[model samples]
Target: MRREQPSTQEAADDRTDALRTEATSSIVGYRLRRAQLSVFQRFLTVFESLALRPVEYTVLVLIADNPGRKQTEIAEVLGVKRANFVPLVHGLEQRGLVERVPSDFDKRANALHLTQEGEAFLAHARQVHEDMEQELVARLGGEKARKTLIELLDRLT
Candidate 1:
């Protein structure tokens, strides 16, 4: 008697299972990248309703915390190149979530500030973020493990 052929998805799954990742898995950078991708995937799903990306949420938080900071300074802190950072800021400004004002310290610079709408949106976003953090902490085996992992990761940076 002849056996039935496996379905395409089953064949693909078999191939995937047969692949070896041990070499890359042992690398710190590879593991960190894999972790980041997993976290970001969850982040995207959680923030989908708010129409926010991880970087955008990060930028908003920075502006809220450091109101009146120079755009260049904030961008530098986040390691975002000026060219790419400009369009990100412009999009936020166009959405009326952020505003740019002339800097008092540097006539050539623009200070960044979040609008009232931004403040409101960020307040809600913060709660959502906190929830996500709690879930991650639990998955990491609780707060102590989470803290340890963060400390180890910080050392790399």
Candidate 2:
């Protein structure tokens, strides 16, 4: 029998399989990042039809929960910088999903609120999110494991 060289695709596959990740695999930060990526990937798939990104969804939920919260206040809680936060809020406002009105407490600051459309959209999003969360919970081995995982993650933050 004659020896034969692997094809280009086969070579690439071999290289990929041979790559090592052991150095990072056991690290807490690396594991956390990988888990985050995996979860976010599933989240993106579930929310694809809604066309909402993770941060946008978070912002919407925060505003919905705190209807009269000032933009700066929400941004601070989310740890988003003012420069980046401005464009994010503007995009939401342009989509007619959010509104910025003068803050009752601070004349110069804008209070965030969801529009009627935003509320309707959020109601749908909430249902979708709940479904996704249930799937994640099941994957994590039920509600108790999910709670424990969340508690551990919360400690890091």
Candidate 3:
């Protein structure tokens, strides 16, 4: 007698189980990272529609709030390397969203400022982001969602 082939659904279910077993067998940290990526994937879907990277959005939001922030200070607040920010700053400059000016505190350092366009863009992008957050995480609502996510991320760090 010949053995019958497995059904498609059974094969797919077996594959999923195998993958899950493999995923769970690895280090706990790897599983944690995988879960974080899954959650943030949804977040990227929302933010990507704005046509701005999260780092770029953070820079614009920071500059809008802290007018005349020095490049060093901006890098420090965002925990990004000072040199790495040069390209992002240059891009913002090219887009007419930001301006670099002589620093009042230090002759060698340049201060950052958001141009009119940057401010307007930040405001709109932030509002859209908030709406998306609400839509995706209505269970946590506004403040609770942020607080919960922050708490969870803090524990990971």
Candidate 4:
């Protein structure tokens, strides 16, 4: 008796199933990383037209919400290294989306703010982000489950 070999699609499906049952599946950090990757993919899809990276969007929001805050403070709050964050700020500044002014309280520090164009862009980005979040919450079984997951994740941190 001869046995038939699995087709290409069948082999791919088996590999996918294997990944689901992998040892890392039981680990919280691994699972969280996988979830983050999935969510970030969705974010990219939703934000494709905006042409902004995830960190860029967050930086815009932070500067908009806390105008006149020092650049270093914003970078610290975001857990981004000062060296790495300077390029991000510079790119936004070059795009005319953000500005850095000499801090009144501290002459050595540079305070951050969004330009008019940045504000308008952020308003649209916020709407897109909210819509994407709503889609994620709905997929996660609605507002209650979303809130519970957020609380659990908060506890983990």
Q: Residue 80 lDDT in model 3?
A: 92
Quote each prediction's TM-score. 0.88, 0.87, 0.74, 0.87
Give the higher-TM-score candidate: 1 or 3. Answer: 1
Model 4 Cα lDDT, one tens digit per residue, 7-49 = 9999887784434576778899999999999999989888999
Q: lDDT by residue for model 2 over 1-157, one digit each (tens)?
A: 9999999999887784566889989999999999999999999999999999999999999999999999988899999999999899999999999999999989999999999999999999999999999999999999999999989999998
lDDT of each: 0.94, 0.95, 0.82, 0.94
lDDT of 2: 0.95
Candidate 1 lDDT, 126-156, residue by residue in tens = 9999999999999999999998998998998
Q: Residue 56 deviation, candidate 3, in Å?
A: 0.5
Least accurate 10 contiguous residues by lDDT in model 3? 16-25
Instruction: TM-score for candidate 1, please give it.
Output: 0.88
Alpha carbon lDDT at 29, candidate 4: 95
Task: Supply candidate 2's per-residue lDDT for 45.
Answer: 98
Runs in model 2 deviating more than 4 A are: 1-18
On the 0 to 100 scale, the lDDT of residue 104 in model 1 is 91
**Cα deviation of 38 in candidate 2 (Å)?**
0.7
lDDT, candidate 3, 1-157, per-residue tens: 9999899998887784433576465877777687568657766787786777778878998988899979999999899997899888999999888999999999799999988888888889889777766765665576788788779869977
Question: Any residue pairs clashing in model 4, and if so which?
Answer: none
Q: Please identify model 4 stretches exceeding 4 Å from their true place.
A: 1-22
lDDT of 1: 0.94
